[model samples]
Target: MKNTLLIIFVLFIAAQIIQTPRDNPLSDPQKEIQAPKEVHAVLKKACYDCHSNQVQYPWYANVAPVSWMISRHVDTARQWVNFSVWEDYTQEEKEKKLKEIFRAAYAAMPLSSYMAMHEKANITMEERKLIRDWTGVRK
Candidate 1:
Protein backbone atom coordinates (compact mmCIF):
# COMPACT_ATOMS: atom_id res chain seq x y z
CA MET A 1 0.00 0.00 0.00
CA LYS A 2 2.84 2.37 0.80
CA ASN A 3 4.48 1.68 -2.55
CA THR A 4 1.21 2.31 -4.38
CA LEU A 5 0.74 5.59 -2.57
CA LEU A 6 4.26 6.68 -3.49
CA ILE A 7 3.68 5.92 -7.13
CA ILE A 8 0.44 7.85 -7.12
CA PHE A 9 2.12 10.84 -5.54
CA VAL A 10 4.90 10.74 -8.11
CA LEU A 11 2.48 10.55 -11.00
CA PHE A 12 0.44 13.46 -9.67
CA ILE A 13 3.57 15.57 -9.38
CA ALA A 14 4.62 14.71 -12.92
CA ALA A 15 1.23 15.67 -14.28
CA GLN A 16 1.35 19.01 -12.52
CA ILE A 17 4.84 19.56 -13.87
CA ILE A 18 3.52 19.16 -17.39
CA GLN A 19 0.91 21.81 -16.67
CA THR A 20 3.40 24.57 -15.81
CA PRO A 21 2.67 27.62 -17.92
CA ARG A 22 5.14 29.44 -20.14
CA ASP A 23 4.82 33.21 -20.13
CA ASN A 24 8.00 34.79 -21.47
CA PRO A 25 7.50 38.46 -22.25
CA LEU A 26 10.16 39.31 -24.74
CA SER A 27 12.38 42.17 -23.44
CA ASP A 28 13.18 44.88 -25.92
CA PRO A 29 16.22 46.82 -24.77
CA GLN A 30 15.46 49.61 -27.19
CA LYS A 31 12.27 50.43 -25.34
CA GLU A 32 13.70 50.02 -21.86
CA ILE A 33 14.82 52.84 -19.55
CA GLN A 34 18.60 52.93 -19.85
CA ALA A 35 20.74 51.09 -17.34
CA PRO A 36 24.11 49.47 -17.50
CA LYS A 37 24.29 45.82 -18.60
CA GLU A 38 25.60 44.95 -15.15
CA VAL A 39 22.48 46.40 -13.59
CA HIS A 40 20.30 44.58 -16.08
CA ALA A 41 22.10 41.32 -15.45
CA VAL A 42 21.79 41.72 -11.70
CA LEU A 43 18.05 42.31 -11.98
CA LYS A 44 17.63 39.55 -14.55
CA LYS A 45 19.37 36.99 -12.39
CA ALA A 46 17.89 38.00 -9.05
CA CYS A 47 14.60 39.77 -9.69
CA TYR A 48 13.30 38.57 -13.04
CA ASP A 49 12.27 35.18 -11.72
CA CYS A 50 9.31 36.78 -9.99
CA HIS A 51 9.14 40.38 -11.14
CA SER A 52 9.29 39.76 -14.89
CA ASN A 53 7.54 37.42 -17.28
CA GLN A 54 10.59 35.17 -17.76
CA VAL A 55 10.31 32.80 -14.85
CA GLN A 56 12.78 29.92 -14.66
CA TYR A 57 10.97 27.36 -12.58
CA PRO A 58 12.89 25.13 -10.23
CA TRP A 59 12.45 21.37 -9.81
CA TYR A 60 10.06 21.76 -6.90
CA ALA A 61 7.85 24.02 -8.99
CA ASN A 62 7.15 20.87 -11.01
CA VAL A 63 5.74 18.92 -8.05
CA ALA A 64 2.04 18.49 -7.52
CA PRO A 65 0.32 21.49 -5.89
CA VAL A 66 3.71 23.17 -5.58
CA SER A 67 3.49 24.16 -9.23
CA TRP A 68 0.11 25.73 -8.60
CA MET A 69 1.45 27.97 -5.84
CA ILE A 70 4.49 28.97 -7.85
CA SER A 71 2.42 29.69 -10.94
CA ARG A 72 0.03 31.86 -8.99
CA HIS A 73 2.86 33.81 -7.35
CA VAL A 74 4.67 34.30 -10.63
CA ASP A 75 1.56 35.45 -12.45
CA THR A 76 0.53 37.84 -9.72
CA ALA A 77 4.00 39.30 -9.21
CA ARG A 78 4.47 39.82 -12.95
CA GLN A 79 1.23 41.73 -13.14
CA TRP A 80 2.39 43.99 -10.33
CA VAL A 81 5.68 44.93 -12.00
CA ASN A 82 6.92 43.61 -15.32
CA PHE A 83 10.51 44.55 -16.14
CA SER A 84 10.04 43.29 -19.71
CA VAL A 85 7.36 45.93 -20.15
CA TRP A 86 9.24 48.60 -18.22
CA GLU A 87 9.13 51.09 -21.05
CA ASP A 88 5.34 51.00 -21.03
CA TYR A 89 5.40 52.79 -17.71
CA THR A 90 5.76 56.58 -17.68
CA GLN A 91 9.18 58.10 -17.00
CA GLU A 92 8.26 59.14 -13.47
CA GLU A 93 6.64 55.78 -12.80
CA LYS A 94 9.69 53.95 -14.07
CA GLU A 95 11.95 55.86 -11.71
CA LYS A 96 9.61 55.20 -8.82
CA LYS A 97 9.44 51.52 -9.68
CA LEU A 98 13.19 51.29 -10.07
CA LYS A 99 13.65 52.91 -6.69
CA GLU A 100 11.31 50.35 -5.19
CA ILE A 101 13.15 47.51 -6.86
CA PHE A 102 16.46 48.86 -5.60
CA ARG A 103 15.13 49.17 -2.08
CA ALA A 104 13.80 45.60 -2.08
CA ALA A 105 17.03 44.17 -3.38
CA TYR A 106 19.10 46.16 -0.92
CA ALA A 107 16.93 44.99 1.93
CA ALA A 108 17.31 41.44 0.66
CA MET A 109 13.63 40.67 0.32
CA PRO A 110 13.04 39.19 -3.13
CA LEU A 111 15.63 36.41 -3.19
CA SER A 112 16.11 35.60 0.46
CA SER A 113 14.27 32.31 0.02
CA TYR A 114 15.03 32.09 -3.65
CA MET A 115 18.76 32.11 -2.96
CA ALA A 116 18.40 29.10 -0.71
CA MET A 117 17.11 27.00 -3.61
CA HIS A 118 18.92 28.77 -6.43
CA GLU A 119 22.35 29.90 -5.39
CA LYS A 120 22.72 31.97 -8.54
CA ALA A 121 20.00 34.26 -7.26
CA ASN A 122 22.24 35.22 -4.37
CA ILE A 123 23.60 38.71 -4.90
CA THR A 124 27.18 39.52 -4.08
CA MET A 125 27.79 42.77 -2.23
CA GLU A 126 29.41 44.23 -5.32
CA GLU A 127 26.44 43.26 -7.47
CA ARG A 128 24.07 44.93 -5.07
CA LYS A 129 26.26 48.01 -5.11
CA LEU A 130 26.07 48.09 -8.89
CA ILE A 131 22.30 47.91 -8.83
CA ARG A 132 22.08 50.68 -6.25
CA ASP A 133 24.45 52.87 -8.18
CA TRP A 134 22.59 52.36 -11.43
CA THR A 135 19.25 53.02 -9.83
CA GLY A 136 20.56 56.41 -8.71
CA VAL A 137 21.62 57.28 -12.23
CA ARG A 138 18.21 56.60 -13.75
CA LYS A 139 16.32 59.87 -14.15
Candidate 2:
Protein backbone atom coordinates (compact mmCIF):
# COMPACT_ATOMS: atom_id res chain seq x y z
CA MET A 1 0.00 0.00 0.00
CA LYS A 2 2.78 2.42 0.97
CA ASN A 3 4.73 1.65 -2.22
CA THR A 4 1.67 2.30 -4.35
CA LEU A 5 1.09 5.65 -2.63
CA LEU A 6 4.73 6.67 -3.21
CA ILE A 7 4.47 5.87 -6.91
CA ILE A 8 1.29 7.92 -7.19
CA PHE A 9 2.95 10.88 -5.48
CA VAL A 10 5.97 10.69 -7.79
CA LEU A 11 3.77 10.52 -10.87
CA PHE A 12 1.76 13.51 -9.71
CA ILE A 13 4.92 15.54 -9.23
CA ALA A 14 6.22 14.51 -12.67
CA ALA A 15 2.96 15.52 -14.32
CA GLN A 16 3.20 19.01 -12.83
CA ILE A 17 6.78 19.45 -14.06
CA ILE A 18 5.71 18.71 -17.62
CA GLN A 19 3.48 21.80 -17.71
CA THR A 20 5.88 24.59 -16.72
CA PRO A 21 6.38 27.16 -19.48
CA ARG A 22 9.76 27.51 -21.20
CA ASP A 23 9.19 30.72 -23.12
CA ASN A 24 11.98 33.24 -23.59
CA PRO A 25 10.65 36.78 -23.44
CA LEU A 26 13.98 38.49 -24.03
CA SER A 27 14.21 38.33 -27.77
CA ASP A 28 15.39 41.94 -28.06
CA PRO A 29 18.97 42.02 -29.26
CA GLN A 30 19.44 45.48 -27.77
CA LYS A 31 19.37 43.97 -24.31
CA GLU A 32 22.93 42.85 -24.69
CA ILE A 33 25.41 43.16 -21.84
CA GLN A 34 28.58 45.27 -22.24
CA ALA A 35 29.81 44.68 -18.72
CA PRO A 36 32.83 42.49 -17.89
CA LYS A 37 32.12 38.78 -18.23
CA GLU A 38 32.59 38.02 -14.54
CA VAL A 39 30.28 40.83 -13.57
CA HIS A 40 27.73 39.67 -16.11
CA ALA A 41 27.83 36.12 -14.77
CA VAL A 42 27.43 37.36 -11.22
CA LEU A 43 24.47 39.46 -12.24
CA LYS A 44 22.93 36.54 -14.13
CA LYS A 45 23.34 34.25 -11.15
CA ALA A 46 22.05 36.77 -8.66
CA CYS A 47 19.61 38.91 -10.61
CA TYR A 48 18.42 37.40 -13.91
CA ASP A 49 16.42 34.55 -12.35
CA CYS A 50 13.86 37.06 -11.19
CA HIS A 51 14.46 40.42 -12.90
CA SER A 52 14.98 39.62 -16.55
CA ASN A 53 13.02 38.08 -19.39
CA GLN A 54 15.89 35.68 -20.09
CA VAL A 55 15.76 33.63 -16.94
CA GLN A 56 17.93 30.52 -16.85
CA TYR A 57 15.85 28.71 -14.31
CA PRO A 58 17.34 25.85 -12.35
CA TRP A 59 16.02 22.28 -12.13
CA TYR A 60 14.00 23.11 -9.04
CA ALA A 61 12.31 25.95 -10.93
CA ASN A 62 11.36 23.44 -13.64
CA VAL A 63 9.67 21.08 -11.18
CA ALA A 64 5.88 21.35 -11.50
CA PRO A 65 4.78 22.10 -7.93
CA VAL A 66 7.00 25.18 -7.68
CA SER A 67 6.58 26.47 -11.25
CA TRP A 68 3.60 28.65 -10.40
CA MET A 69 5.44 30.39 -7.59
CA ILE A 70 8.50 30.79 -9.79
CA SER A 71 6.47 32.29 -12.63
CA ARG A 72 4.78 34.79 -10.34
CA HIS A 73 8.08 35.76 -8.82
CA VAL A 74 9.56 36.27 -12.30
CA ASP A 75 6.66 38.45 -13.36
CA THR A 76 6.94 40.67 -10.33
CA ALA A 77 10.67 40.86 -10.68
CA ARG A 78 10.48 42.02 -14.31
CA GLN A 79 7.99 44.67 -13.34
CA TRP A 80 10.38 46.14 -10.80
CA VAL A 81 13.39 46.05 -13.16
CA ASN A 82 13.60 44.50 -16.58
CA PHE A 83 17.22 44.37 -17.63
CA SER A 84 16.13 43.59 -21.17
CA VAL A 85 14.33 46.93 -21.18
CA TRP A 86 17.04 48.65 -19.22
CA GLU A 87 18.33 50.63 -22.17
CA ASP A 88 15.01 52.46 -22.24
CA TYR A 89 15.62 53.94 -18.82
CA THR A 90 17.33 57.30 -18.50
CA GLN A 91 20.91 57.21 -17.29
CA GLU A 92 20.03 59.00 -14.10
CA GLU A 93 17.09 56.74 -13.45
CA LYS A 94 19.18 53.68 -14.18
CA GLU A 95 21.87 54.79 -11.77
CA LYS A 96 19.26 55.56 -9.14
CA LYS A 97 17.57 52.19 -9.48
CA LEU A 98 20.88 50.36 -9.38
CA LYS A 99 21.86 52.23 -6.23
CA GLU A 100 18.54 51.50 -4.60
CA ILE A 101 18.56 47.81 -5.46
CA PHE A 102 22.18 47.39 -4.41
CA ARG A 103 21.48 49.08 -1.09
CA ALA A 104 18.62 46.71 -0.43
CA ALA A 105 20.74 43.76 -1.52
CA TYR A 106 23.57 44.76 0.80
CA ALA A 107 21.10 44.93 3.64
CA ALA A 108 19.73 41.57 2.56
CA MET A 109 16.22 42.92 2.03
CA PRO A 110 14.90 42.55 -1.55
CA LEU A 111 15.78 38.86 -1.95
CA SER A 112 15.97 37.28 1.46
CA SER A 113 13.75 34.40 0.42
CA TYR A 114 15.75 33.93 -2.79
CA MET A 115 19.04 33.85 -0.93
CA ALA A 116 17.60 31.32 1.45
CA MET A 117 16.96 28.96 -1.43
CA HIS A 118 19.96 29.73 -3.68
CA GLU A 119 22.98 30.08 -1.48
CA LYS A 120 24.96 31.40 -4.47
CA ALA A 121 22.64 34.40 -4.61
CA ASN A 122 23.73 35.49 -1.16
CA ILE A 123 26.01 38.38 -2.13
CA THR A 124 29.54 38.09 -0.86
CA MET A 125 31.43 41.10 0.49
CA GLU A 126 33.63 41.13 -2.58
CA GLU A 127 30.69 40.76 -4.91
CA ARG A 128 28.88 43.57 -3.14
CA LYS A 129 31.92 45.77 -3.49
CA LEU A 130 32.21 44.94 -7.19
CA ILE A 131 28.58 45.83 -7.77
CA ARG A 132 28.87 49.05 -5.85
CA ASP A 133 32.03 49.96 -7.68
CA TRP A 134 30.52 49.16 -11.05
CA THR A 135 27.42 51.20 -10.38
CA GLY A 136 29.44 54.06 -9.03
CA VAL A 137 31.60 54.04 -12.12
CA ARG A 138 28.55 53.96 -14.37
CA LYS A 139 27.15 56.96 -12.56
Candidate 3:
Protein backbone atom coordinates (compact mmCIF):
# COMPACT_ATOMS: atom_id res chain seq x y z
CA MET A 1 0.00 0.00 0.00
CA LYS A 2 2.83 2.43 0.86
CA ASN A 3 4.56 1.63 -2.43
CA THR A 4 1.32 2.23 -4.38
CA LEU A 5 0.75 5.55 -2.60
CA LEU A 6 4.33 6.66 -3.27
CA ILE A 7 4.00 5.76 -6.95
CA ILE A 8 0.79 7.81 -7.24
CA PHE A 9 2.39 10.78 -5.54
CA VAL A 10 5.38 10.61 -7.82
CA LEU A 11 3.19 10.47 -10.91
CA PHE A 12 1.17 13.46 -9.72
CA ILE A 13 4.35 15.47 -9.18
CA ALA A 14 5.67 14.42 -12.59
CA ALA A 15 2.45 15.52 -14.27
CA GLN A 16 2.96 19.05 -13.01
CA ILE A 17 6.16 19.35 -15.01
CA ILE A 18 4.30 18.87 -18.31
CA GLN A 19 3.95 22.30 -19.86
CA THR A 20 0.57 23.54 -21.14
CA PRO A 21 1.02 26.71 -23.12
CA ARG A 22 -2.11 28.83 -23.21
CA ASP A 23 -1.04 32.14 -24.63
CA ASN A 24 -4.02 33.86 -26.22
CA PRO A 25 -3.14 35.33 -29.57
CA LEU A 26 -3.63 39.04 -30.02
CA SER A 27 -6.78 39.78 -32.03
CA ASP A 28 -7.92 42.95 -33.76
CA PRO A 29 -10.97 44.47 -32.09
CA GLN A 30 -12.58 45.01 -35.48
CA LYS A 31 -12.34 41.31 -36.29
CA GLU A 32 -14.51 40.24 -33.39
CA ILE A 33 -18.11 39.21 -34.00
CA GLN A 34 -20.63 42.02 -34.41
CA ALA A 35 -23.82 41.66 -32.45
CA PRO A 36 -26.23 43.75 -30.46
CA LYS A 37 -24.71 44.86 -27.19
CA GLU A 38 -27.03 42.56 -25.25
CA VAL A 39 -26.15 39.55 -27.37
CA HIS A 40 -22.48 40.41 -27.20
CA ALA A 41 -22.69 40.58 -23.43
CA VAL A 42 -24.13 37.10 -23.22
CA LEU A 43 -21.56 35.76 -25.64
CA LYS A 44 -18.76 37.49 -23.79
CA LYS A 45 -19.86 36.02 -20.50
CA ALA A 46 -20.53 32.53 -21.79
CA CYS A 47 -18.77 31.82 -25.09
CA TYR A 48 -15.66 33.99 -25.27
CA ASP A 49 -13.55 31.99 -22.84
CA CYS A 50 -13.40 29.00 -25.12
CA HIS A 51 -14.43 30.44 -28.46
CA SER A 52 -12.34 33.58 -28.62
CA ASN A 53 -8.69 34.59 -28.29
CA GLN A 54 -9.47 36.40 -25.05
CA VAL A 55 -9.71 33.47 -22.68
CA GLN A 56 -9.87 34.35 -19.01
CA TYR A 57 -8.21 31.29 -17.62
CA PRO A 58 -9.32 29.91 -14.29
CA TRP A 59 -7.15 28.96 -11.33
CA TYR A 60 -7.16 25.31 -12.27
CA ALA A 61 -5.80 26.23 -15.71
CA ASN A 62 -2.38 26.39 -14.08
CA VAL A 63 -2.62 22.91 -12.54
CA ALA A 64 -1.73 19.65 -14.24
CA PRO A 65 -3.93 17.07 -15.98
CA VAL A 66 -6.92 19.40 -15.77
CA SER A 67 -4.82 22.20 -17.26
CA TRP A 68 -4.03 19.97 -20.20
CA MET A 69 -7.73 19.32 -20.72
CA ILE A 70 -8.57 23.04 -20.63
CA SER A 71 -5.80 23.90 -23.06
CA ARG A 72 -6.80 21.17 -25.50
CA HIS A 73 -10.47 22.07 -25.27
CA VAL A 74 -9.76 25.74 -25.97
CA ASP A 75 -7.47 24.82 -28.87
CA THR A 76 -10.15 22.59 -30.36
CA ALA A 77 -12.85 25.20 -29.80
CA ARG A 78 -10.77 27.88 -31.55
CA GLN A 79 -10.31 25.63 -34.56
CA TRP A 80 -14.06 25.11 -34.80
CA VAL A 81 -15.08 28.78 -34.58
CA ASN A 82 -12.91 31.62 -33.35
CA PHE A 83 -14.97 34.75 -32.87
CA SER A 84 -11.80 36.82 -32.56
CA VAL A 85 -11.08 35.99 -36.16
CA TRP A 86 -14.63 36.29 -37.41
CA GLU A 87 -13.80 38.62 -40.30
CA ASP A 88 -10.95 36.36 -41.45
CA TYR A 89 -13.32 33.62 -42.55
CA THR A 90 -14.88 33.58 -46.00
CA GLN A 91 -18.56 34.41 -46.44
CA GLU A 92 -19.52 30.74 -46.74
CA GLU A 93 -17.50 29.88 -43.63
CA LYS A 94 -19.23 32.62 -41.70
CA GLU A 95 -22.64 31.35 -42.77
CA LYS A 96 -21.74 27.79 -41.82
CA LYS A 97 -20.34 28.98 -38.50
CA LEU A 98 -23.45 31.00 -37.79
CA LYS A 99 -25.57 27.93 -38.51
CA GLU A 100 -23.41 25.95 -36.15
CA ILE A 101 -23.77 28.62 -33.49
CA PHE A 102 -27.54 28.57 -34.00
CA ARG A 103 -27.64 24.83 -33.47
CA ALA A 104 -25.20 24.90 -30.55
CA ALA A 105 -27.07 27.71 -28.81
CA TYR A 106 -29.63 25.23 -27.55
CA ALA A 107 -27.45 23.09 -25.26
CA ALA A 108 -24.18 22.00 -26.84
CA MET A 109 -22.52 25.36 -26.25
CA PRO A 110 -20.32 26.46 -23.39
CA LEU A 111 -20.02 22.71 -22.86
CA SER A 112 -21.40 21.25 -19.66
CA SER A 113 -17.91 20.30 -18.54
CA TYR A 114 -16.84 23.94 -18.77
CA MET A 115 -20.01 25.18 -17.10
CA ALA A 116 -19.33 22.87 -14.17
CA MET A 117 -16.38 24.94 -13.08
CA HIS A 118 -17.59 28.24 -14.57
CA GLU A 119 -21.11 28.94 -13.42
CA LYS A 120 -21.00 32.38 -15.04
CA ALA A 121 -20.49 30.74 -18.41
CA ASN A 122 -23.79 28.90 -18.12
CA ILE A 123 -26.19 30.27 -20.70
CA THR A 124 -29.60 31.15 -19.41
CA MET A 125 -32.59 30.16 -21.53
CA GLU A 126 -33.16 33.80 -22.41
CA GLU A 127 -29.54 34.22 -23.44
CA ARG A 128 -29.76 31.10 -25.56
CA LYS A 129 -32.83 32.46 -27.31
CA LEU A 130 -31.12 35.79 -27.81
CA ILE A 131 -28.13 34.07 -29.40
CA ARG A 132 -30.36 32.05 -31.68
CA ASP A 133 -32.25 35.15 -32.68
CA TRP A 134 -29.02 36.99 -33.40
CA THR A 135 -27.77 34.19 -35.61
CA GLY A 136 -30.86 34.64 -37.82
CA VAL A 137 -30.46 31.08 -38.96
CA ARG A 138 -33.48 28.86 -39.41
CA LYS A 139 -33.58 25.50 -37.64
Q: TM-score for every candidate vs. truth? A: 0.74, 0.69, 0.96
lDDT of 2 at 53: 76
Q: Give all candidate RMSDs, comma-separated.
A: 3.8, 4.3, 1.0
For each of the candidates, give the backbone clash count. Answer: 0, 0, 0
Model 2 lDDT tens row, 50-128? 8777787777776666776787788877787777777877888788778876775577543777778788766777877
What Cα-based lDDT does every candidate model obtain?
A: 0.75, 0.73, 0.90
Stretches of candidate 1 exceeding 4 Å from the true structure = 1-20, 26-29, 137-139
Can you tell me which runs of candidate 3 are displaced by over 4 Å? Answer: none
Q: Considering every candidate listed, which one attains the maximal TM-score?
A: 3
Among all candidates shown, the one with the greatest lDDT: 3
lDDT of 1 by residue, 23-93 (tens): 67678766654568888888788778888766787777766577777788788777767877888898888
